[model samples]
Target: MMKILIIEDEPSVRVGLSFTLESKGHKITTAENGLDGIRIFEREGFDIVISDLRLPGADGIEVLKSIKNISPDTGVIIMTAFADVKNAVEAMREGAYDYISKPFEPDELLIVIDRFIKHKGLELENIRLKEEIRERERFQHIIGTSPAMQRIFETIEVIAKTDSSVIIYGESGTGKELVANALHNLSPRKDKPFIKINCAAIPETLLESELFGHEKGAFTGAVQRRKGKFEAASGGTIFLDEIGDMPLALQAKLLRVLESHTFERLGGNESLTIDVRVIYATRKNLKDEVKANRFREDLFYRLNVLPITLPPLRDRKEDIPLLVNHFLKMFGEKLEKSDLAVTPGTMDMFMEYDYPGNVRELKHSVEMAATLCKGTKIERWCLPAEIRGDGETPDAVISVFDDLPLTERVKTFEREAIRRVLEETHGKKKEAAKKLGISRETLWRKLKEHGFPVSPSDLEE
Candidate 1:
């Protein structure tokens, strides 16, 4: 089943070896000398090469070196006499796969070849697994190509070089944690620990002790001393999610730590210093929180040095197709459903629907669809009921129609719908027209009439 090259000077030995290997079902190519063997190897691929330690033009070590330099993956077995064992050892040291003693039994040669084949199989499998992992994590787990996402990628690249605190603003389920991870991984402290704690998820009573460390017997449950997120993330990054929900009282202490990189553990006056980079994420607007007297003004400015606002899925819908494909491939492999895909109608519906729950929701929807998919492809009916507009009204726009006349309401809705679709498509008028169920010329005229921004070339039918 394997292609083997036999390079031996003795005609009798070469023929006998070829006969023995061929009888074992291996395809053997015989070469009279080292030079011919090297030439054959260069012209055609072989799984294993067997060469004598002593030869006329090029010796066994020379052949091994040449074969290794050409194809490192090819298994080379050096055949040497008892006295030439030293040279065979040198050949192995130079990268020969293994060495075989001359006048050895056919069983011995077969064993070495079998071992080499198994090892090569394992090596190839390892390479394949690594490539799969790389493909899945191509964008650090953040999948998108919309113009808004492109800008975010650029911003992350520019800011990752520094250790300044950053504030990421986005709606819930918009991958705020993913963005925080990307920033940490892209930064210099990537190798260090990255600790995360949801400010809103943890109770306000224990939030301070969670941010800083606690001494033994500090609180009712403090039976032992413990390090908190900042301590655990020293020399690394700490991601504080839903930071807008952090209690105002704790915000002052957080601001002190951000400004001075020092904080005292609860019930412990001794200040502990740490070199930790902070990344804050929030669904609520801190500016509004500040106006409402819920967030401190000075703390807002301290954390808002580098601000990043992630657009919602509805606002960057052009990336839906790419995200759909990514999740399909991702969950397809997980669910053992190879070659899984979405129908065109399903894809069109995805492009039209506004994802209020953002990328996280889209990912879950794809996962569920892939799980329930009976065929190789996911049909329109396989999608969630909400996506199919069966369970409820598609969006809330219809509720506001009572405030204006019928004509003005219809025109306003049309203009707003076109605008949102265009934004999702990244201003690609052709795709926008298709999603709107209209011709390119009609979409173009509507764009001009509604005063929507678009490229001139995009209007071409």
Candidate 2:
């Protein structure tokens, strides 16, 4: 049921409309004047308002404006006499949903109310779906559990509540953008726009217009006026990725905006003020670039206000198992291979390898393995050559495992020995157990403990 408010100077008309709407299962509130209607609308949160165009103390247009100012989504229908149709048209222009003449039939009002309800329902549903997508993207795409990542996450939680300018420092593919996104999503301005610009992606000649907007005929191809990322992100955040690569000339301009919160579009003399938080990410060392005279020192300090450095994946090898499992479940459902599993040998190889491209490389490696593997289990052969550790001797493997704890060392050695025996026997589990001098049930227990499949399909030799 809906809440309907009727505001009419004529008591008979107001009561008649109220009775008609109430009969349709809608709760009705009738007011004798515009002031009383506005008060009732504000206090009771009416879904639809019907008001006479001409009123006593205040007019219907005034009440309409007041209601919209408080709740823009509230549907308003102006009730005007035949001679006041011009005022009704003016009300519609000022955002009145619809207008009905004073002598209108009850069915006409009901039809408009039904249409508004359907439209509102669809709009609310779209908002919910968008929020769900954003929630999944924010939490699922970012994978990390190391101490370094935990510190970064803690910093994000603390600083996201503030409107501070932040600088995220990390190597390429280290998920700097993911950190920036988390900060935006957790901030007060999450409902507003989040504009992202790759400083290195666009040419230097066009970078300024992309950041500060451009007027018509601003340049050779500026045929129409356009608002840039800063203007679009007026109430939210603007993420500047690869900030170190931005031209030195543009860096000075960006610094000016950061300090004053104002900028003029290209070929426009009028300055425009904007309210936006800035987040910068870079793979290069800005201090070194400043010393080398490639980056402006002032701009570097301005962007480095709240610094967060993300650790490389090789430094957080402990997270590989969790990340592997996450991607396996993700891609398994994505690719329609729901029962896929990686052998313990493959996981050991992954744990030992160094990832220069960081988490991005690991995700891609898993995706590729899942896509290309024909069997239910992912084997060492399904992995990339560098990740397989094929040429590494036992001593070399020991060196890689040296930094891990004693328990991890034992697990790594056991996984490697079982893998080698399984390979020698062409994935015959019983024969491989005999070769490893362990019983079949014991081998199965070890495989289970190491996240390997104990069946023939899990071997994938």
Error of 2 at 169 (Å): 0.7
**True-structure RMSD, every candidate:** 15.9, 17.6
CA-lDDT, candidates in order: 0.85, 0.85
**Model 2 bad stretches (over 4 Å):** 1-140, 390-461
TM-score of each: 0.57, 0.56
Tens digits of per-residue lDDT, candidate 2, 1-461, equal 89888889897887888888889999998888888888888788889898888899689999999999989999999988878878988999989999988688989989989989999999999999898556434433676667777677779889998999999999878889988998999899999999999999999999999999999999999999999999999999999999999998999888888888889999998889979999999999999999999999999888888999999888999879878988888888987888989889889988988899888888877986786555589866556556876686656655665888998778777776776676568668878878888877788888777655556554443
Model 2 worst lDDT run, 10 consecutive residues: 132-141
Model 1 scores worst on lDDT over the 10 consecutive residues at 391-400
CA lDDT for candidate 2: 0.85
The clash tally of candidate 1 reads 2
Clashing pairs in 1: 317-424, 318-424
